[model samples]
Target: MKTYVCPACGLVYDEAAGLPEHGIPAGTPWADVPESWRCPECNIGKTDFVPMEL
Candidate 1:
């Protein structure tokens, strides 16, 4: 699995550790995330996120 980072607020979204707080289950892939989902910290769209390097 991969991880993504919100460029606006530096929030990290890990595919292997899905954001269950926001209703995304564990193991959810980045592409499976909803288009309407926004960064919890910055309130920006998914487009504002970039692939994060491990």
Candidate 2:
């Protein structure tokens, strides 16, 4: 599994459990993350996520 890091707050997105059940609005794009996934802490778009070594 790949772990995603939030560039805004340095929060790591867990691939084991996946995105939260309900934090980011429903239908939020997670597939093409770096282009659409939003930061749960800051609500910033995917552009804020920086892939880190997991």
Candidate 3:
């Protein structure tokens, strides 16, 4: 699975280790994440996230 990084705060969202704290279960894919879900670290929208290089 791929990972994403928040541009504002460098928060890393790993697809294999979903954000359970935000109700996103483990192994959840990026496309499955709600559009309204913001970065927990910086509160930035999903558009602010970029694909991180593995």
Rank the models by lDDT, top first.
3, 1, 2
What's each prediction's TM-score?
0.94, 0.58, 0.94
Give the per-residue lDDT of model 3 (tens digit) for 9-32. Answer: 999999999999989999999999
Q: What is the lDDT of residue 10 in candidate 3?
A: 93
Residue-level error in angstroms, candidate 2, position 5 = 0.6
Off by over 4 Å in 3: none
Instruction: For candidate 3, give the lDDT of residue 15.
Output: 97
lDDT of candidates 1 onward, in order: 0.93, 0.61, 0.94
Clashes of each: 0, 0, 0
**What lDDT tens digits, residue by residue, belong to model 2 across residues 1-54?**
556688778877655556656454333444534455567678877766666784
Global fold similarity of model 2 (TM-score): 0.58
Q: In candidate 2, which residue pairs get closer than 3 Å at backbone N, Cα or C atoms, i.e. clash? A: none
Pick by lDDT: 2 or 3, better one: 3
